[model samples]
Target chain A: MKLYELIIIGAGPAGLTAGIYAARKKMDFIIITEDIGGMTKYSWDIENYLGYQFITGPELVEKFREHINEFNVEIREGQKVIEVLKDEENFKISTKTDTYFTKTIIIATGRRPKELNVKGEKEFRNKGITYCATCDAPLFRDKIVGVIGGGNSGLDAVLQLSRIAKKIYLIEIKDHLTGDFFVINKIKKIDKVEIFTNTKVVEIYGDKFVQGIKIIKNNEIIELKVDGLFVEIGSIPNSEIIDFVEKNQYNEIIVDCKNRTSHKGVFAAGDVTNVFAKQIIVACGEGAKAAISSFEYLKYL
Target chain B: MEKKVIVYSTKTCPYCKLAKEFLKNNNIEFIDYDVGEDREKLEEMIKKSGQMGVPTIDIDGEIIVGFDKERLKQVLGI
Candidate 1:
């Protein structure tokens, strides 16, 4: 088996940027990912990413893909990494179909959408419940939909659904919206959106499809009839493939200033790591740093 | 007879793009529908899949929701 100098385990903002840096350094590396854009593709309006004043999630990811494509980088898409094992000096990454050996590894797998875990959620999945508004909003055209969460993701879903759905019920457990001020202000102007703060979805009920949701607000139980439900509460880190690394309570890999994990020759970046900010630009910078750090570590080997 | 494949998707959906690219790369022929613009196709997609999600692929008569590459490979016998 040919051992690679490095293997980047994702193709999101972090993994893509790491690939660009690794290619510039002329490192023998390849990226293994289930998808190209990761969570960035689910975003609606991204005004914070540097260089572009405004860009959608998929648009920004397209630019990233283009940039990485400029280099002769190898990206194995549609391959999900099932396990990562360290054997003596090299790390072995096992996907569903094949296994790869690398001298160093960069984990930038990012995160996945957090589930509501309430009743009837699992039963109604894909029936009337969805996680990606960008992919499923058009199906709820002219119908009533409920959005759970007041964070950026939830607000983004509402913004997209406002143009499609007839009525939107924005439910949040907190007393106020927790997303960016700009998004909150934008959502406030939409009269069709009914904001319910300090509310909890107790149960979801329906027949084959979702018919309504039971929510508790101010010590009172309220039933809402909706055609679709979008869960955008938050996300959990995708850091379970490797169990040797230390993780916080949220399962986010712990990285130092240089994006180095507790285990040597293994680095992590982006939302998967314990980074203060989970911004796209932040992930990109961390990815570059992880690449450089891995390159430096490889010098002694 | 060749298997008929239909993909219901939107232009802005990344998963939809990925599914189309997968089909193209595998030398599979499929008809793409932009449900975001075509309301009739959108309704058709919902009625067929019993759900509202992009990249809903119809292979022959089986409806596979989302970009299940494994399922696609198995159903298509690729």
Candidate 2:
């Protein structure tokens, strides 16, 4: 087992940016992730990423990939990191397929879509329920679909489904749509869409397939007959696999301004960290910080 | 009618890409119904498999969900 200088455990904005920086600094590092681009690929449209006024999530990810491709960075795509731990002076990174040893580690494992924990939610998973709008919007074409969560993710689903589904039921547990003004304004013009605020999904009902979803709004329980349900309530940090590191209540790894974790040499970055603002550009900066910090630490050793 | 191999997929699904590649690698000619492009095919897909996940393969009425390699091998006899 060849031990590298650094191991970054994600391929999202943070991990990719870190890889590019590490490569430029001539630091030997490897990125292990289940997929590249992470949740950014699921984004319908991105307007806030600096240098581009507007670009689709996939398009932005493509640009990132192209930028990283310029460097001879080693990215082990399609590999899921299962466990990460300290091995004396080096860190042991474990994936489903293999284990790697590195002097430093950067955890950029993003987040997964939070599941709607209701009755029949799990039974109907992949049956008539999905998470990624970019991945499953087409499967619900011309069918009545309900989207859970009123944030940007739910709005993203609505924007994507508006062109595909026959009708959309945007169910938000809050009192109002909490997405950006641009997206909120766009969906407002679509007559095929219905927005329900201050509504909570209490139960999901079905037999062989998803028949409908039960909800409570204004103190009234109502059953909505639909073909599919998309849970986009938000996400929890992907940091549960490694408990040796300090984490917040949301399971996000605690990191300092320099992206250093509680344990020396084990760094954390991106949405998996305690960073309040989980954005692509922000993650990139933090990733670079983690890489540079790791580089500095490696120099002393 | 010949034994048809149809793959109901989305444009962005990784499993769908793998399923298509798996079929192509086995010299299996399959009809790709991209749900993202063809709305009608999407409805047909949901009706048949009762699944929303992409890369649902229909081999002459035998439906397999996701990129199940072992199941694909069994169904295609490859």
Candidate 3:
């Protein structure tokens, strides 16, 4: 098996930034990712990332991939890393297709979408229930849709659906909508959007296509009929592959100021780490720190 | 003789683009069908492919789902 000086586990902003820095340092490394952009690709627009006033998430990632394509660092796509074994001196990373060894490892695997866990949620996935609004929004035009949760993602989905779908049901378990105030104000004005605060999606009922959602509020059950259900409850860190690694209460891997973990040759960055904000800019900043730290670590060995 | 390759896909699917790119890069001639908008063709594709996902390639009657690069390489003798 071929060994690398470093192996980055993800290919999002964090992983891409790390690859750019590593390549600049002339380090021999490889980035393994199932998808080049990760969950961030679902974002419709990002005005926060530096150097650009406004950019789409997918477009930004395309530029990031282009930046890396200029480098010597290898980029292996469609590789889902399933396991990581940290030995005394080196680490062995195993994917569904191949195994790789690396002197140092960067755990920028990031997070996965939190499941709704309601009945028929899994059975009706892609049938009508989708997590990615940007990806599946076009399929929902002129249709009736319901969005679960009250966070930024849910609010964003509601806003997106208001323009396309004929009707939208914004169901939130909390008493108030918990997204940005500006977004909430905009979504509240749309006549097609009917807000159902303090409502919980108890069950997802569907067959070949989503039929409706069963929501409970104040001991009363209300079933809202819709063709599509967008679940944006929350996110879960993608640390299942490295369960052996120590993590905090939120399942976020604890890292120092430099993104180093409790393990010697292992580092982590982005949403998976215990960072205050889960923005693209923060992820890129953390990634740069992790790469520089890794470079410094390699010098001692 | 060059084997006939047909791809059943949708406009919105990213996987379909990848499969098409993979085939194009290998200089393979293939027929394209958008199953999303074409309901009749979608049913026909599901009946043949036994799957609902896009980027289903029908290589001379053999159906393959997604972009299985290794399998495609094997069948194409690339």
Clash totals in order = 0, 0, 0
Q: Model 1: what is its DockQ?
A: 0.41
Best by DockQ: 1
Question: Alpha carbon lDDT of residue A121, candidate 1?
Answer: 97
lDDT for each residue of candidate 3 in B22-43, tens digit (9 for 90 to 100): 8998899999987755667766
Which 10 consecutive residues of model 3 chain A have the lowest summed lDDT?
A: A132-141
- Encode model 2's per-residue lDDT on A6-41: one tens digit a residue: 999999999999999999999988889888799887
Q: Could you tell me the lDDT of residue A1 within candidate 3?
A: 69
Candidate 1 lDDT, tens digit per residue, A1-301? 9899999999999999999999999999999999989989878679998889998887788799999999999999989999999978889999999999999999999999999999999999988899888778877878899999999889989999999899999999999999999999999999999999999999999987899999999899999999899999999999999999999999999999988999999999999999999999999999999999999999987
CA deviation > 4 Å runs, candidate 3: A1-3, B1-78
Q: Give per-residue CA lDDT, model 3, range A1-301, as digits (tens).
A: 6778899999988998998999899888989999887766656578988899987765687788788889877889889999999765889989988999999989998998999788888788866788776555555667899988889998988876777788999988889999999999999889999999988888888766679889898999988899888889899888877866689988999999989998888999999999889999999999999999999999998
Question: What shift in Å separates residue A134 of candidate 2 from its native position after superposition?
Answer: 3.4
Best by TM-score: 1
Error of 2 at A286 (Å): 2.2
Between the candidate structures 2 and 3, which one is better when assessed by DockQ? 2
Provide the TM-score for each candidate, comma-separated: 0.83, 0.80, 0.81
For candidate 2, give the lDDT of residue A236: 86
Ranking by DockQ: 1, 2, 3
Cα error, candidate 1, residue A78 (Å):
2.8
Q: Is candidate 1 or candidate 3 better by lDDT?
A: 1
